[model samples]
Target chain A: MIDKQVRTVAEALEGLQDGAAIMISGFGEAGVPAELIDGVVAQGACDLTIISNNAGTGDVGIAALIGAGRVRKVICSYPRMVGSRHFEERYRAGELELELVPQGNLAARIQAAGSGLGAIFTPTGYGTKLAEGKETREIDGRQYVLEYPIQADVALVKAYKADRWGNLVYRKAARNFGPIMAMAGKTTIVQVEDIDPLGTLDPETVVTPGIFVDRIVRIADAGKAAA
Target chain B: MSAADTIQRLDKQQLARRVARDIPEGAYVNLGIGLPTQVANYLDTAGDYFLHSENGILGMGPAPDEDHIDWDLINAGKQPVTLLNGGCFFHHGDSFSMMRGGHIDICVMGAYQVSTRGDLANWHTGDPDAIPAVGGAMDLAIGAKQVFVMMNLLTKTGESKLVEHCTYPLTGLGCVSRIYSELGVIDLGPDGAKVVEMVDNLTLEHLREMTGVDLTMAQ
Candidate 1:
């Protein structure tokens, strides 16, 4: 039952199928799961419905998936890369279906979904074109805003070190969407630098629980030093 | 203490009034993307009321004058924004962790239905026709210590928007503490809904007549 055989991030991501709603964590390259992205690209998984904070600068993070022509739809907030604007151009050209979300809304929607909330409301885009075709209600006598859930089928996350049982801790920006999306998905696969035995991690720092995670792949420093 | 002077019909000037009084010195606030954004327009803050945008901007100031609206510096809504003198850029994730972690002191947001029980249902009405986008309201409602709602008193159909229970999708259950309306200020506290003040010339009965829910006067 124990598979201690470690692999590259790309080797681990090599088996995904089509039409998977994958949630990848990271604000940018800071904590982008290099192996996870490489794996997804190596596998050539297509028709991917990606849910993340951003698509990252092209040639990095989830943008690599976009570059591989593996992503079918992107449910992200911002997709602009610094200088290389072609990925967005490809999206606008209908090569990729882009579903933009307000950054906060995107995070909350993911949290709401993970929490089993039927729905949540806010006035983020009230009285604008964004509020079009939305249900308007009167409460106490004032108008409020509304939105729905954002669930994922597969969540790709990176952690600094994870107990084999899947307790995760992220360093800084790499922690962005991991813990939340870890709870918000059906199958959460974590790629980490070190995999430890149970009871090794401090309870307070273990931000994610073992129950939310399904798979883990360790990226050894020696094996990934050149990468 | 005077009802007529304490609360006014939150017109442009009245909203301007609340914005001036409610925001204290050296506060960090996020003007919730829409009507709550108007708060920035009425600040008497001679120096700072650091604004946080979930889109990763901190130390945000007010909307710039018509001529200075910068394209690169935008708020969460993708609308152009201006930063205060000491503002700087950082990771968006840190901005959100600050939001969800309760580092934020106050948040001024718009509401659809704030229950007498203080439940907030502002995201979606859950109607078949309306498509709601449940955003960070849940995070802000639960994350902020004191949640202040700014809203109009009626729907376009003349129905009250505040209610006993939120019928639409909820942003957060029982998160609202106070509401600043076109009519007056209502506090949703432990005892029930208490009217701290009324819009000038607007009587309790008149307020009741305009609302679908029962109105209990403040002690």
Candidate 2:
């Protein structure tokens, strides 16, 4: 029997270490694995490097973790938001480092890491400050900037449904970074609203396959809680 | 009344409607956050065009009513939005691929500054105290087939945003195709900035003095 289901958020985050590179999946409040993030906060891992689309919105989830002084750096496309005071304060106080990449380049770089690519040449950042330190080449007539993959030691993902084998499906826009992060993380932990029996989810609708996900924690009320 | 006394600029809604008029029917468009988002309102009555939100939605609709708000469904700006019939969602990788792959027909963005050569500078002001965030600005600037900018022609201090060259950090080079501003509409290309229209009672000479860049009248 191949089962990857875990009973609690603590068990799902077991063996986490300090100074780890973690990819927290979400775009704004949608699809954020808040429970797992809270577990990381409770687990007390320090010096974490987080990669996400946004830094954090309020004093919750990623914001709470950063507020707890757990994160040392953030690599994301957009970190400035309405309630992102913690990230701003930490950044201004010289306590946190930021690497701001354009959104397309950020997604492509993460995809490249999961696909086992050395690097990608994207037209998004060409002729801009984001491409300043990188190598550039003109393929045909269009210029492209070389961007490297962003790999993580662990990825925390939120999905709508999953099976014991860990095949996952997500809800609407909440699916933002879950699938890609699942592949890029060496040990991917997923918090799903429901864990179905074997062969329950139609294979055609599965977004992330079992091979990419390592552990699944069922948080039945996560959707309402996040709302 | 004197011509100067009669001069009037378009309001933000009027400017948005002006930009909306230029979008061809059935074009796939992405509107950047802030002022450019207003374009969607005018677009509703125009024709059938698909709205693309960078967070992974196509066929995106207007803001949902309070009762229908879903936290799981939101726009790139993180505002609650409705998904129209035939709408679909994907992950970040596929969403950005649709942008960088040149599948987006047009993108309307708000600008801090734009050069006569079509260079864009909206991501940052180089302020030392600011925490810079780029988001998807660069991608939409360069990736879309036609890039249209929506902004006020002048800063609050009365300086022109359309310049000979942008002083701020660049987002993309030679990417903008047109600019819709409070004062008028201008098209950018290899030739130079050409005036397509101007507000009533606004003269070419006064427009020239305000812009600081040489302008040619469109034939």
Candidate 3:
């Protein structure tokens, strides 16, 4: 196990390869791992498939990858709001692929993948254009739609604090996609603002246990740092 | 109704009943996670008007059976929601496309502010410590053919939420076509906004007095 913490975003991204299906945790800008996203951009990783809720505007998060010309497919629900003009141009020019998911279903898919469930049935958008070509089954005289699993090679999550054992605790909306993706990824990396000693974290507060986290990277306070 | 008789006196639930009256037979709608979600209780969706919860379940009729709620099948806000007969679940990716891709017919949502230009501001109150979660509001606001807003005219601070321009963050720009308030229904148009319907006893002056922006009623 890589029990070490990386010093730089570049060092933190050393394990990610091109074409990797990476799941990023965030809702708008709240829970996004700003440092990790900056690292992905700085590392110049390309041809990536990013799974996220919404692309934090073009200058941040998955949008940076979209800007770096590194992203291939985006499995997200909303792109136009955040993706910059460059992203829009790419999407319209066929430079990028978009896989839209409902916000709730996106969370569930991530959770479902994490929970080891093969699939689930929801009637969210059925009998409309969204149901095009999907396999439909009748359960109890009502039609339920089936959605498959969502797994990825790596997942980047931001947590407020983490213990040396890699247990994580998130503050606010940052917690939404983090824990779910932790279980869904082959290698889950956490970027946290604070790192504490092992056993220091209250057991009840452990949002993502060490078993789900493969690595830890601590971020020095970016806002207060001297230029 | 004139702009004068905009909002007389009504509560959010009362407004929900007015919104419920508009549910057409067999139309599909996704009630946004917050106050707009209360509309589900007033509509008769037993067999029609499929209610969709952004968290990925349809055939939605009302809140989950209080006696048998399932946390796993909750909506975007993690509130327990129930499925009507024939309801199913799918990958969230597909469901969002249905939203952004413009497959759903209507989406009832809550707004912090709606501009005369029809811009929608919701999901953020500018509190840095507050969670910035816009689950499916923007997608639903723009994707659905018709967007209905259910909101209080003023914030707790007593500021008018409807404005000439949005001072807060926006979920979508110029996406709303009409609005239903405790006062009445105001249709967004090219020349600012016009009051199309009002509560039985209010007037345009009363609406302007209680609103954050200038008011106009359709002649």
Order of quality (DockQ): 2, 3, 1
Model 3, runs deviating above 4 Å: A1-4, A224-227, B1-219
By the DockQ metric, which is better: model 1 or model 2? 2
Query: How many clashes does each candidate structure show, in the order listed?
Result: 34, 0, 28
For TM-score, the strongest prediction is 2
TM-score of 1: 0.56
DockQ of each: 0.05, 0.76, 0.07
Question: Candidate 3, residues B1-219: lDDT per residue as tens digits?
Answer: 555444365688898998888878787788876687888778864447777655445675455556665434456655555666677654344466667667888888888888988888775676654324445665576678788888777667767878998877676667787788877888885688889888777777877887857778877
Tell me how far the alpha carbon of residue B160 in candidate 3 is from the true structure, in angstroms, after superposition: 27
lDDT tens per residue, model 2, B90-109: 99999888888899999999
Per-residue alpha-carbon lDDT of candidate 1 for residues B1-219, written as tens digits (9 for 90 to 100) = 655455446685576567558778777787786778777767766657778776566787656676775444566665666766677654444566667667887888888788887877766666754322444566677667778888876777878877877776666656678888888888886566888888668899878777777788888
lDDT (C-alpha) at residue A60 in model 1: 58
Share of native interface contacts recovered by each model: 0.04, 0.90, 0.05
Best by DockQ: 2
| Chain B TM-score, candidates in order | 0.87, 0.96, 0.88
Measured with DockQ on alpha carbons, how good is candidate 2? 0.76
